[model samples]
Target: MPLTLLPTRASYGPGDPIGIELRGDPPAAAELSVWRLGELVHRQPLLAGAQQTLPELPAGGYGIELEAAGGTVARTAIEVTTDVRARLRYGFVASYRPGKDAAAVADFARRLHLNGIQFYDWAYRHADLLGGGEQYDDALGQPITLDSVRALVASLRAVGTASYGYAAVYAVGPEEWPAWQQHALLRPSGEPYALGDFLFIVDPAAPEWLEHFRDDLAASVAAVGFDGFHLDQYGYPKHAATLDGTPVDVAESFLTMLAGVRDRLPDARLIFNNVNDFPTWSSASAAQDAVYIEPWKPVLTLGALAEVATRARAASNGQPVVLAAYQHVYDQAPAEASDRATAFTMATLLSHGATQLLAGEHGKLLVDPYYVRNHEAEPRTLEFLTRWYDFAVEHDALLLDPAIVEVTASYVGDYNDDLDVAYQEVEVAEAAVPGTVWRRVTRAGDGLVVHLINLVGQGDALWDAPRNPLGKTGPGELRLKFVRGRMPRVRVADPDGRPRLEDVEVRIDGDHAVAILPALDIWQVVHVAL
Candidate 1:
């Protein structure tokens, strides 16, 4: 029998004792170790199959492990925060089909540690958001019910998770064309711009279109009680026109439409998808909670992911960024290959300070634009994701703290300064080199976090393609100047490894300090505390 441990809730607030469900070959004579950063802050005995509550912890990320008498360890990460939104872990709930359990959906999301959920494709029509009184087919001919939507909202909210209903910002079906034609966004040939035959594009900032959508949104809120809306786009028509031949700059219109929306619905949260970055620069400063990007062609590599995440965060003035980068390759790849690719995607996005929409609709994951077409996640994938998510939650501050600024260019490589990773003669660049270790450097206060992603075995850089296991890059060293003589206290962390975090010994030279780097596998973050 294998030992298993899971937290009862995604997070706990101040003064709340931590609870865990321990079973499945319960440990005999176990000791719990509670660690914060590189320090072991708390430790105590834990009993198997017992209703035990660990003492309340401070507001920060924690790594807890219970070592059984036989030396087996059942481990999990814990977050103690005043608000669940601090980390902003995101997920999706797309199933509104009959017989789908709302409570179960919420539970799955909680386990994923998602504080917000995009209720993907939970509407009858993109234009008429709330239809199908009890239950009816959606725009794509899938079962959906208003009752199911409301129940999901209530259930998710009960767990500290927000629910956002999905709606296309400027889309209407052919049946709605007559009412919205005057505001239609037309192509150069004078034909309406549409996504195939299903959704016709319209000027999002059109006065009439705004008013109509506003009413539909307001009504949806009154009925289903969602926290907000996820406004989507078909990612085209960068230049278009209204039916009356008025020229339109699609990117510029987002600000006007979003501003008007904020003015009308001041309390409603808004999240917009800048698909393939069709118009992110202008929309990033718009009134939205996070910068959401749905990457397709051209924006496919890990280096590109870093660029997008960095630029989006800067453009949004430090807003949350999420990559809706689906993994359709899972359809053709074997289970091991898919998991490896997923791990690569996680390393690329999360290490770049953005989250990925990896899970959705219960046990499924989004593999395509159509949320309903999600693939059932393999048990291996789920287990892998859960551990990575645990690692992410444990040190989100080091990874996403707005104060942490990139110093990769300034301090590493051909630099304004010198911070070098001692890899073999192979070229090491800030942007990952195929068959080389990718090093990204960042600093906040006296601490510097260097992310090392092993790209040593790959020939291609597509983030969604199948990945080969990392090549062994044995113990190396990170050498940097010791200006101001800030003594180093270095700690390394990896989600896929035992003892999630371990302190590494540092050596000091006359003018520099070197921290030993353990053999690289998937991804590792080294925090040099000064």
Candidate 2:
């Protein structure tokens, strides 16, 4: 018999009671345990088919473990935070029909701890943010209705998920271009910049255009109850001209547009797509909830992925970051290998203190830029995804806290022997070197975090290629050189293989604290509390 235990929502506020759905039959020895970090704080007998409303938990990360026959049967995690904006776990959905299952979609997102969802292409047009009457086809020829959109908005909001309507900031439909031609952005060829004659671009900073955009956004919220807008743009034609031949710098215009958006919708949550890091340096500090980027082109390798994440976080001045990286690698390879690729990219983003806009309606994953072209995640992919998101939520203080600073180069590897690490079959490389283990170290609020990623047996550092799983491995090693007054208590977790945090024995040998790792999997986050 299969058994499952899932939280009713992604996250709970301080006053909300935690709800757990229990399915399948439970053995006589079944028990539910609650853990905070390395210590087990609560345990009680549990029955199958029971509606469990857990008492209020303290504000912190927790591991909810279900055990039977003296072994852990299932493990999951939950977060009770005072501020959900500490980390923005984003998801998206493009399907918006009247018959769609809005409740089920919200359930899937909440289970994965997705607190922010973008309704991709759920509008009548870029210029007309709301549909006429109740039913209409979106700009991309997708059939959507106001009923479904509002249903999803209400469902997601019930679980504390903010709904963002996807709004193309400049694109105007072909039929609407002529009426607004005077506001169109002209190229040097005396033609309005357009996308293959399907849609034309407009000057976002124009007074008339800005007023139209803001009014439509407000109407969308009033019509369908959207919490905010996902501002979009095509990453081309960096420079354009006004109809009267006035020079226009696209980046500066974007800054002006964002400021106006913030001023108009001061209470709503806003997120803009910084496509390929274009003008991110200038707009990172703009009026957006997070520094979101859609990476492409040269950002195909593992090192490149990490670099882009770092760049976005730095440019944003540490508010929050999101990567809309579509995993086309799944289409190139079978599910067997593609699962590893999915895990690798997720690890790279989460470790860099950024979330991903990948998950969508019904637990699907966004694998293409066209939001409608989502793909079903393999069983293995789903399993690891659940664990990783759970672990991240449980360790938000270390992973998403802006006060944390990465110090891999100065703390680990060759010459830097502060917290040295070693592995058998693989050697710790200086950087993200393919066919070798990648080691990283960060200083967080509660402790020092050391991240280890398994890059073994990989042909190259490219993130878009399939990879081998971490599989089973022998023990690894670690040694801390300088031991101060506080004898560090070591805690380790590999969300893929071990979602529960385990307290490892730290032997104090004179001035050093040493330990032996049972194994290293796809990724492991080790926290040493001083």
Candidate 3:
């Protein structure tokens, strides 16, 4: 018997529909069934030369089996990933160039355990790169070709990662300058404006201009094997002439483009870079897989990262939140201080469920040789990122799943405001829930997992609202609570490795358990199994 199924390797977010195709021998009279962990949930007739769509299923591993007149004809496994509704999957934005073969890039991705890769500096039209001065190849020194991109994407998928293409939609080729002159974002006098004499922005509303841009973008998608598009809009003011003629909102125009792309490639993921007015772009509720915000100007802090995560989640209706924070900013400080800050930023963001983390060189930002070479050859930076990658993989269940138990501890006030700073000194005798701190507790079968973070700089840190970040006050002893049905073995791991349970004390109450952590710098997790 010959049998086939559509999308042999299928993936779906929660609530997403899935189309299943089955083909086999005639008069086979097969009973098609789908099972979750061996429990039959779905059954249907098998029609020759026909296909059917399966009902929406929850996120889990499922098996599809077909029983025919002869016997069990075929069985296949299907996996449905979690929707990531309230969670995030941290990814790397820049191109993966390890100054060697493509395998080097794959190695870096594996080391980082990245889920997504944004191909850096790829453009289709002449104006997209170098403002029409010259059309050059990509960072690989070879001309950007469809085959190259396909190979690149295949490599990424080989390592269990997704790929996204980067493009500047509003940019125009120098050869198209005259056509875009009046349609470009202009100066005060309605004349074509220039950005440092090299780059110019096309009025997003211009009909003809929009068509040309869309055509180029569509072709790029077809030529490149990208899982999605990363629309980069360098936040700048609109030109009067272009603004007057165009009725579509600039942000809305981008959304329209995204919709068009989705229409063309239904399975592809979509993302945007909100450079300056990211908040405005984020608020639009456009259909996108994720939102990327630079957060460059406001100076990223633990509080700032948390706010972005919250806002992005709200704006996207719980889509993944991605922040492109510069790692070098933290690296410039004292070695230990810089490492702590970087780790703190990553931990805070992960705890809050931010999706992606971007690291770039600072000072003389080197892209050609130094940064790329170091990214592949340097051990220190790789080790730094490896720590984060390992943490993300180990606790993917808690990170991706909705919070079973959410707790907040107060240490510092809103770092964004000044008055909150003054309250830092007041040191209330009572403990308050800190805005930046987050603890997500989850249960796997009989095992309990907790993900915790301390975002504040001062105050006695607490396990269950005991001490502040400074280890000052609260319950001196640790507490543990249980479901009360059965007693379970318990183990704990710091940011490092697991310690002896004998040294740590744990107490259990009905349906709740708490562990008093020793004085620590960043975060800790406790695991309990019954």
Estimate TM-scores for all models.
Answer: 0.94, 0.95, 0.63
Ranking 2 against 3 by TM-score, winner: 2
Q: Where is model 2 more than 4 Å wrong at Cα?
A: 47-49, 413-415, 469-473, 484-486
Each model's lDDT comes to 0.80, 0.82, 0.51
Range of the 10 consecutive residues with the lowest summed lDDT in candidate 3: 416-425
Q: What does candidate 2's lDDT look like per residue over 1-530, in tens digits?
A: 46667787888899898877776666676788888765787887775466566778888888888888869887777788887766689999889887889988888877788889999988887787764668988777788888999999999998888899999888899878877889888878898999888889998888889888998998888898899989999886688888888888989889999999888888888988889998799999897888999999888887888898898888887778898988887778988788788788888888888877778798788888888998888777777678888888877777787778888778775577688778767778757887777888899876788888888878787777788655444677878875577778888988866676687888888777888876877888888886
lDDT of 1 at 466: 89
272-371 per-residue lDDT for model 1 (tens digits): 8999886888898887788889988788888888788888878866778888989987897987888888888888878778889878657688888988
lDDT of 3 by residue, 1-530 (tens): 45644322224466666655554553456777776533477888875566556777777645556677786565444445764223334343333332324554554554454557666565544344323222345433444444545666776677556777777667654556766776677666665555555557775545676666556556666665677766676666532445465433466556666666556557667777776345344333766777667665564355566666656655655466677655553323443444555566666666666654554221111122112331222445445555555455445444434332233222123431211111122232212234333344445454555444544444422211222223322322223444456555555544433211223455654444444554333565555554
Q: Which candidate achieves the best TM-score against the true structure?
A: 2
Residue 483 Cα positional deviation in candidate 3, in Å, after optimal superposition: 7.7
The C-alpha local distance difference test score for the whole of candidate 3 amounts to 0.51
**TM-score of candidate 1 to 2 decimals:** 0.94
Number of colliding residue pairs in each model = 0, 0, 32
By TM-score, highest first, what's the ranking?
2, 1, 3
Error of 2 at 159 (Å): 1.3
